[model samples]
Target: MKTAIIYMTKHGTTEKIAELLKSKLEPGQTQIFNLKKSKLIELDNYETIIIGGSIHVGSIPKKL
Candidate 1:
């Protein structure tokens, strides 16, 4: 099944996590998108969508 690891990161922690997920789920296909800078506007192709983000000042980011 095709999957997407969509995430937002301020200090790259979220991107790192996404990378880990990508490594584990390779051969399927995975890409990490920064919510603030990414232009991707659709999610129709992903059979499974994994959203992730990092916490700053003990609060979750808006992209989470």
Candidate 2:
């Protein structure tokens, strides 16, 4: 199955976690996107979507 790991990180921690998760999944079947850098992401193409973001205080980032 195709997987998309979309994430937003403040201090790069969330990006690291997303990469780790991708490593555990099937090779070349997973793709990662950073919300801060990516302008347009076609999420409809992915079968499984995993969203991750760094928590600050009590909530996630507004961009997320």
Candidate 3:
């Protein structure tokens, strides 16, 4: 299976979590994208996708 981890982090906590997940998952075609610097990616190519975000001051980022 193919997987993509797309994440946006204000303080990088979410990015770390994404990395940990990637490390624990079974080996396969996997990619990670940081929303802050990545252009629109073809998420359709991935059969499974994970999105990560964080809350700050009781509010989540608009990108999430």
lDDT of 1 by residue, 1-64 (tens): 7787878887887788888888888575766666888776478987789988877789887656
Task: Show where candidate 3 strays beyond 4 Å.
Answer: none
Candidate 2, residue 15: how far the Cα is off, in Å? 0.8
> Which lDDT tens digits does candidate 3 get at residues 1-64?
8899999998878989999989988787788899998989998899999988887889878976
Ten-residue region with minimum lDDT total, candidate 1: 26-35
Whole-model lDDT per candidate = 0.78, 0.94, 0.88
Give the Cα error of residue 15 in candidate 3, in Å. Answer: 0.9
- Which ten-residue region of model 2 has the weakest summed lDDT? 54-63
Instruction: List the candidate numbers ranked by lDDT, top first.
Output: 2, 3, 1
Instruction: For each candidate in turn, give its C-alpha RMSD to the true structure in angstroms.
Output: 1.8, 0.6, 1.2
| Residues 1-64 of candidate 2: C-alpha lDDT, one tens digit per residue | 9999999998999999999999999999999999989999998899999999988899999999
Clash pairs, candidate 3, are: none
**How do all models score by TM-score?**
0.77, 0.95, 0.87
Q: Model 1: residues >4 Å from true position, as ranges? A: none
lDDT of 1 at 29: 74
Each candidate structure's count of clashing pairs: 0, 0, 0
